[model samples]
Target: MTDIFGVVADATRRELLQVLLERYLAPESATGDISVGELVEKLGLSQPTVSKHLKVLRDSGLVAVREVGQHRYYRLEPGPLDVVEEWLVPFLSVDSLGGGLEQGEASGAFAAWSGVQMPASLRRAGESLQHPSDAGAAVGRAMADATHGTRHRFEEASEAVERKVFDPIRKKLKKD
Candidate 1:
């Protein structure tokens, strides 16, 4: 396998990835795949230059190609990004920003959010509102509780969808 980091280091390749990501997120995108001509036109680059970068991305498994007649379509493949996200999680911790929270607490939050961590400073601020001396603390705590509950529910729903929908589709694709 190509070095994933090295393949993504080029500015053009990153731009290509960004374009694919945008198409993937667009509601009108049926398959989230774009043709080489469309990419060349969108990025205002020569077709050969785009093709070269696309070859690098394809070799690194950052993108997948689908052939339709004589034309080729490309789509972003996000599986490899888990490696980058895992390596960056520690650097993104609240403790790394400043003297805020313990590394373990920060990492725990990152794990809970699957790569995104709630800043330790924010978490501590919420906890500090537990003081009985201020009536405002009661309202703050209530709001915090509601937010936490909502986040937990969202996480649960996401997990359910991944298991019931995406996981099965991935399994079938692999078997083929």
Candidate 2:
């Protein structure tokens, strides 16, 4: 089996994965699974070329396949990508800007939503990004901007749910 690094090293493979995601995983118009022909058309590659990339992705367990008659349908397998995310947490921290975060909260909060625990070393790495100095001001401002944006979106989504879902039920119960 090829390692994920090797499988994703090729730009074509990444593009293939994007094609599968955009076509089959789009929440607005997802059709569930995608076939090799569709990938070839979207990727503008030959069947053999597309199939070769799919084989590598399948071997690395990055893509799951369903056999239906003679056609094979492929979908993304997200489990293996968590390893890549773990490796990336340190880099994603504000280490370069000299201020990371407190208590690995960034990765911890993100991972909590995904139901995965952040590793200890990675958590420490995130905490180590916290630096209190003049230079850290820039990083803090950036973090604040991102946090505000995320919080605003979450609040908006919560309000929408309350209005469109819970409010109607509340009104019905009151009527009853």
Candidate 3:
């Protein structure tokens, strides 16, 4: 197995990963796959240079390639990132921070904001937000949390309305 750290160590490779991530997050990108020519145009790099970095990424299982006729498309393979995430989780733990934030407080505060259970990795990341020494930072985080909560609630309501109202009406209309 190639060292995942080594595979991601290059600046160009990281840029490539960021590009792939952007495509994955884009609403218009149905497949989240990008062609070599698109990547070359986006990054302003030569095709051979992009291909070289992509080969390294492919070997390390960080990206997957699909061949369509003669052209190839690449998309990010996020599974291999578990190795990095697992390694980093310990460092994000409250214990690792010398008890800066209590686990219960962190979990409770985050749960109240999110209104749902989060994975341990995300909880640990949230724990890092609750430092006792920074009042201003705490206020900032409170505002951000409130904003996120509002957005979450809005999305839930929107989805419910779509399912219970719009979807049924659309179905009825389609039947006629």
RMSD of each: 13.4, 13.8, 14.1
Residue pairs of candidate 3 with colliding backbone atoms: none
> Model 1: how large is the Cα RMSD against the reference?
13.4
Candidate 1 vs 3: which has more TM-score? 1
TM-score of each: 0.57, 0.54, 0.55
Residue pairs in collision within model 1: none
For model 1, give the 10-residue run with minimal summed lDDT.
89-98
Q: How many residue pairs clash in all the candidates, one count each?
A: 0, 1, 0
| Candidate-wise lDDT, in order | 0.75, 0.70, 0.75
The sequence of per-residue lDDT tens digits that candidate 2 reaches over residues 26-103 is 565564578999899877999999999899999899889999999999988867877775565433542322244445
Ranking by TM-score: 1, 3, 2
List, residue by residue over 61-164, the lDDT tens digit for candidate 3. 99999999999999999899889865543333323222344344433344457674544544555677656666467546644654555456657986897689
Give me the runs in candidate 2 sitting further than 4 Å from their true place. Answer: 28-31, 96-176
Candidate number that wins on TM-score, 1 or 2:
1
What's the CA RMSD of model 3 in angstroms? 14.1
Per-residue lDDT of 128 in model 2: 68
Report the C-alpha displacement of residue 101, candidate 1, in angstroms. Answer: 7.1
